[model samples]
Target: MDIFEFYKKMDADDIMLSFKGSVTSELLTSVLQIIEAKMERLNEPSKIKKKVYNVLVESLQNLYHHMDKNEQDIKGHSTVIFMIGNNAKAYSIYTGNYVRNENAEKLQAKLEKINSLNPDELKAYYKEVLNNGMMSDKGGGGLGMIDIARKSGQKLNFRFQQVDNEFSFYSLNINIAKQ
Candidate 1:
């Protein structure tokens, strides 16, 4: 790997933090604390800070809870990748993880459905989901993606690539405006 190239890319993108490894609850807390502290020290406006922090929390939690069940299937130690950055206009977060190939279609459809909604529609959908009280075994009411969209005020960007017949890589990107 070209270390300098990686550094140059990160520098150009103004990356605040990046990680690639297993996602665990402990690491999640540490990263969130670090991000909160950094945002505080930067003197970012409270609203922007909160939005960024919320999106980060949801993003990490989604990976921690919803990542593929067979994470140890010959993939080695690494299981997820997360990166956060800020440019002049917005703060960006990107996360990628392995997912069961069978799940890719459903997830993509859900995300597409979420991305197609306007703010008001999203709010209504969130309320409907809340009222229906349907949750996955993981205890998600299917609201994380909606909450991320509402908080960031941007459509989520995502992609899926087949890794094998049994696994696929899922990546999601979120951006919060500084305005």
Candidate 2:
């Protein structure tokens, strides 16, 4: 979808932020400030704020590391997009990035595995992965998705858009109830 159309689809009761280009520490910090301001304006409860913040940090870091490994250039680069918003009933965060077709397939499989689990099963799986010290140097192995699921208390939402034969845009969304 086009950028304007995407923005229009976002919930009106929520604040929305989008980032394109390289994932940089400075940009991430600025985005965090804007999000915090919006959260304050919405008078979000402390618990919800904490969950949102944690998810944002993990998701952004994942983008940064992924971009770095691929040596992606910042100028005019279409690497990653981070979007956050909420409706009256829930808050949602989304992250999208270009991935090789192979990587996309692997990610899809991983997401499917996570999505198939109940909360208790997910928690057990997360702890098992954690105990095994299987986390990648990127600060996540599979725990981030599980964490998002647990914190949001909802199933992970995701989509994959094929950009070409070789690459696809992988989009993941996490939604949390306001109540």
The most accurate candidate by lDDT is 1
Highest-scoring model, TM-score: 1
lDDT of 2 by residue, 17-42 (tens): 76677888898898888888888898
Native-to-model Cα distance after best TM-score fit, residue 17 in candidate 2, in Å? 1.5
Query: TM-score of each candidate?
Result: 0.92, 0.85
lDDT of 2 at 84: 81
Q: Which stretches of candidate 1 lie over 4 Å from their true place?
A: 68-78
- Give the residue spans of candidate 2 off by over 4 A: 1-15, 72-78
Worst 10 residues of 1 by lDDT: 68-77
